[model samples]
Target: MLKNVSNQQIINVFKFLEAAWSTTQIRSISYEEKQKKQRTHAQKMIDMFDLPTKKKKFETRKPFDYSGDFGELEPLKDDETMFVYRGLEDKFKEFPQNYSKVTSLEYADGQEKMAHRIWTMQEKFLNICKYGERSEMIIAQKTIQIRNLKEHCQKNKKDTLARVILLEQIQGRKKELKKLRKRDYKRFIWLLKELDLLYRPHPLYVDLNTRRARMRQYLREETCRIIREKINAVYTRLDSEKENFYTEKEKVLSEIRKDLSDHNISAYDVLQNVRKLRQERVVERQNKAPPTPNTYRWIQSDKDRKKAERRERDLHRNALVKKGMQKLAQSEEAS
Candidate 1:
């Protein structure tokens, strides 16, 4: 029996079994089980849709008080004071010199350092006189916190809680920054420049999670790639054939020149004369003196000049409208 068995025979048997299985009626479930399954699925969908979309409440961390005068503290002068305020001064100078005047930053713990950093960022973004709780200032503070948390998470690796906090801070900062941008674009730009941040806005229409969206993106990318490749191929072909094209063009030109001479159109070549004229015009333009700056030169016929300018403006507007219409038509056709 084993000797008689072949691979094709085995495959045929499997295929027949598969076909039989496909034709066989499915096992019917009880009404209660069916209802229960449907209910569970419906509840899952309902829960998904009912989930709250409210924005997360971000904690507003107070800016560290950097007002306490550390110089007022009477300590031993010179070398001894340097030892007492060694690491603290350099680390928390931005925080309050008082925190350092008391003890070193490493001994005072990371909280002081974090406060100092936030204060530094706030001082940079906010007004010097009054460090108000402006959106830009808050965003700047969050940005520093995010950076510090990110660094800590990277070093620790197992600190998942820190990572979560970092992500929350990032999202909060992003939302605030976006709001700030909408409220005041100039302030937003200034804040970003001050904080050394690059704002990458989210897409308006595309959701990359869906299969359809992903396929559309892939199709667009492939279309662009194909177009670029085809253009390059066409250019390469043209370059290869240009020598022959130029030779033929020269022959046709010579024949045309001969015919023109025979017809007594002109004694000298008209094209040659045109080329000389173009070169002379270019040379004249190059040699022309530039107009003086900060001085208005009065032109003759100012009324005519104003009329001509208005006419040119109208012509330009009409041309732009025509171009825009053509583009709209092209887009409609493509869609």
Candidate 2:
């Protein structure tokens, strides 16, 4: 993301570059001074970008991040229908989430098959396709949804939590005497898997995926696409807001740098210098290690697992928050 600046500044830089490159008249600029002039030009653009300077101010939390996956962005296309089905194959998993706005893969065989949309191209129409119908401004896509998954365990009276309590009463004999018939082994395996908590997908998602597609599959895809667009709009708005904030901040940063001029770094110059210092150093690997065989290790203690998980979650959250805050602050300032 760009640091900050205004639309006007952007215009000047663009115009300067155009003029400089046009017909090689080159504005009679010196070769040695070219880089310095470019820097000044860019800084002017940044400083001139109009940003908000009101009571709303910069934000400390709730910044934005890249969300390309959510948008169904993919590599360059194969053949047209091939690209379409590839999209379907690629995003069948997402259909259950009601996520992607573009699905060329015809989705027939119910929403349950959203896990793997199988299409048979013959004289017969293969499957329900997720297509789009574009209007003047909107492209409507199909949407698939699961009705409901979470009914209270209290109402059902047969929850895992209850079963766990019962197992505890039997005194840690988790490998209990199920003693089912050999013929019913598969059923027992299903029951066992259903009983496991961590292994399961979210109940709501599972419910949605398991259900049949009530609406046309293409309609579902189109709906998902629309929703995806809405989500994108929200993020784009946030970006614009942040852009405005950063543009506003250039002047403030410049002012602060002016106050510290005795330190030998002008605001823009110091910033550019900071950018220079932040460049990554090329590293050469010296310690080459051989691949090790996988070993079956026992699980860590619950406390240790919990601590590690907590730490991981905390770090991830902190990273996200920090990024968002910085973006939000700069955007607000630039605006």
Candidate 3:
């Protein structure tokens, strides 16, 4: 089935799958983080919504015992913290729309697991939506690609900096994500309004016990439609991603070749030259400049002038030379 698929369709399906997966994964996998945050505020929200009021406010003793100091400071209590959690839950009524997948789960290093969980949800979502091959990863799997490039560079005697350029490209994408946030929030807000109209009246949304602002907008039908469209747009990028990989690979390879030329290193001599260049810079930094002559006008004819200039340059060059290389050459006339 994978073989018969046209390249264009493949790109389309991949993008289709990515968008499908990103949204689905983001929505489904996020519950864990939401649950954790809500667990902290469960008492307050239950009280606010006039739901069953069994849960108690988590209480605590004052950290600092004070009479007059700190202007009669109030004790730091768990109810305040609980209310903050309630506030967040209230503010993010459309929690499923705005939050990315629960990046990190409950523990400190659960971020990777959360990402994987998101991907898994996306996979299942694609299966439901009929997007692409069930096995296709939404985010391109780049570890093998990155490692292979590194190994190739090491074997070919290429510069390490040239080999790592693609890795830098991945890290630099955060700026692109920050740019996305600006536009994404507006879209998110629009989605929230839609949800308010449609889902807010649904039993699950209102009874969430947290009063999300969007639930008041009465726009659930529009919210779902807009999100569906956004998912389509994200899916379209899969083809672009493949093309991006091709371009980035070409760029890195071209740069490696240019690095050799830039340093005048033969492939066989690259390592040897790298060592020599560092030694040269160290010596150059240590050495003092030779004093210049008052002028190279000795007996002022072009040939004598040329010879004088060459002699001066060679003397200075030899003074600056490290143990390995030849001095700057003297005048052609001297030869």
Candidate 4:
């Protein structure tokens, strides 16, 4: 085969091999990694003119601190939530006692410590011979459980179930306490006092939690703020001008005095007449006292309404007695 092969044929074969190698080499070339592209002119134009796209965030306002309205209020120095049981540990020696001989809570197991706490609560809040089913007793039990669970949660952050249970317990306790308060206020007071708990009742109306409501509140606060600022500014301006105003008043008084002299009237006699007029006006005002407001009628509590009625009755009786005395004095004068 080599003996019969022409130079052209051999050259053609070599050319075909070179072409195959070139094709293989082209196919073997790997793809380059994509790079970040520069922004196009159109994209830049859109960015320059178009509004930014963003999530609509809810607007919230800070509630005004009305605590400052109370001038002499003292802030709590210690944690009020951590209720301290007052009395000697030994004094809790009676019926419904924790029979556990574990003297030190430091060495006691979780269950034993919980039982001891419940026993202490029962000792303080439970009535004579009453078991642990009372609302107060239940609240006390749940409170202890919540405190323990809170401690556990702090130690083991992954205990999500405990946290959920803690929240549910708190909500349930709150509802129970609210019911107890409504059903028997005196009992509620006693329970609160024993537990050293602050009774913060929920608002009568549910908060709408809408933007409109928030905006309305914000506007009302703003209006009040503006009014107060304007009033303060007016008072400040008045104070700055007070001296000049008093000087002008003196000048007017002197002119009035001169006029009185020209009219053959004595200033002393005039002042005495003015004093008598003022006294008579004051007496008339005292006799025509304003009637009592019925604002107390808006109070929903029956006890409060009764008390207000009693007060009004007393006031009416006092007024009648005062009128009778005045009439008797007039009759004596006529005699």
Runs in model 2 lying further than 4 Å from the true structure? 1-214, 239-243, 266-281, 284-335
Local accuracy by lDDT, each model: 0.70, 0.44, 0.50, 0.68
Considering every candidate listed, which one attains the maximal TM-score?
Answer: 4
What tens digits encode model 2's per-residue C-alpha lDDT throughout 19-138? 877956646768879999988876664456422223366857421111001122122222223333454665466566333323432332333232222122211121222232111001
Tell me the deviation in Å of residue 161 in model 1. Answer: 7.5
| Cα lDDT tens digits for candidate 1, 1-335 | 86899999999999999999988969789999999999897667546544333547997853221111111112223222233344555566577756555564344446766665566556665554245548877876787777666558768989889878877887888899889889889878877766667777887875657645644666688789999999999999999999999999999989988988798887467778999999999999999999766433455467679999999999999999999999999999999
TM-score (all chains, Cα) for each model: 0.37, 0.18, 0.15, 0.40
In lDDT terms, how accurate is model 4? 0.68
> Which candidate, 1 or 4, has the higher lDDT?
1
The window of 10 residues in a row where model 4 has the poorest summed lDDT is: 64-73
75-147, model 3: which lDDT tens digit per residue? 2222221221333654555667324123223322323433443454465556644464322222222222333
Give the range where candidate 1 is weakest over 10 consecutive residues by summed lDDT: 64-73
Per-residue lDDT over 76-108 for candidate 4, one digit per residue giving the tens place of the 0 to 100 score? 222111123334444445523343223445445
Candidate number that wins on lDDT, 2 or 3: 3
The clash count for each model shown is 0, 37, 12, 0
Give candidate 2's whole-model lDDT: 0.44
